[model samples]
Target: MATRSNQCDFIGAGGIIRDHNGDWLSGLSMNLGVGQVINDEAKRMLSGLKLASNLNTRKLEGESNLAIVAKLLIEVCPISHPLDNIINSCRHLINGFDEVQIRHIFRECNCIADALAKGSLSRDYGIVSVVETVSFDAPPPHAASAFTDDLCDLARAGSVRTRP
Candidate 1:
């Protein structure tokens, strides 16, 4: 998730769904009008989790640049916060999976999603498909590079923190 201003309001949210083999499945980008960054981050995470579940993903791993959002999703963040309702809903979605992992990633490593979010900022308040290639050949010129970058990131060697 990203914000258009220094106050961290007016969010731009985006996420990508990929297979274990690093093949792209689907992706989403949305412009979430005006809200706090953390709130928008949580909302985007819930949407991403729902998308994964819809794709029948059982053992899922998700990463976000916002450590607070990651913490909230895993119940490490304070429970009495204002986003408790949304956080609880996220927990429910997580429980639906056989195994789920949500990790905090550095902003530099989350470039593809960031680019997608920026691309979505100019659109309406809904999903914008940045990349949805289903073929074995190759994606379009603009998306091929982003796809490659995300594939490398997915294949990168890093230990993920377990859910709380």
Candidate 2:
């Protein structure tokens, strides 16, 4: 993800797991919407941790990438939308089909997907990029570094908060 162009970078991704109290964060491994595994490299990063104790239940919850991206798409697409074909296709792939509100996307307003695809591909999180179906010639120079300065300043400059 660090190799995408400037427009491709952002903050608040690749999180590490947090303690129950939210002290530390882990982007240790990715959870695809269903029982699928992507980013085996990330799985290796947290190999030493006992993640089985970290599964999501009613009391303790973790999210898949689809959940996170579907939310953002719902919120800031900058227009009213209808449940559409593309969204249905995505929903079919996603595990919790009931959770997502499918909607149409104007190609013009979906810069988020475009940016995410570039970043995902660069990081070789191909499950995300391929599922998203965005293609590019490869990111330009300074794409990753330029975004590091602004987006890396997470959540009020070193102040982390508990989930409310």
Clashes of each: 0, 9
State TM-scores per candidate. 0.76, 0.24
How accurate locally, in lDDT, is each candidate? 0.65, 0.28
Candidate with top lDDT is 1
Error of 2 at 106 (Å): 26
Residue pair clashes in candidate 1: none
Candidate 2 — which pairs collide? 5-143, 6-143, 15-26, 15-27, 16-25, 16-26, 16-27, 17-25, 17-26
lDDT of candidate 2 over 11-86, digit per residue (tens)? 2122222334533332222222222222221121122122312323112223323332335334443234342433
* lDDT score, candidate 2: 0.28
Candidate 1 wrong stretches, greater than 4 Å: 3-9, 76-79, 126-143, 152-164
Which stretches of candidate 2 lie above 4 Å from their native place?
1-12, 23-25, 28-54, 60-122, 125-128, 131-164
Best by TM-score: 1
* Residue 119 error, candidate 2, Å: 9.3
Q: Write the per-residue lDDT of candidate 1 for residues 48-118, one digit (tens) a residue.
A: 78777777788888887789888878765466899898888888889998898888877766655665665
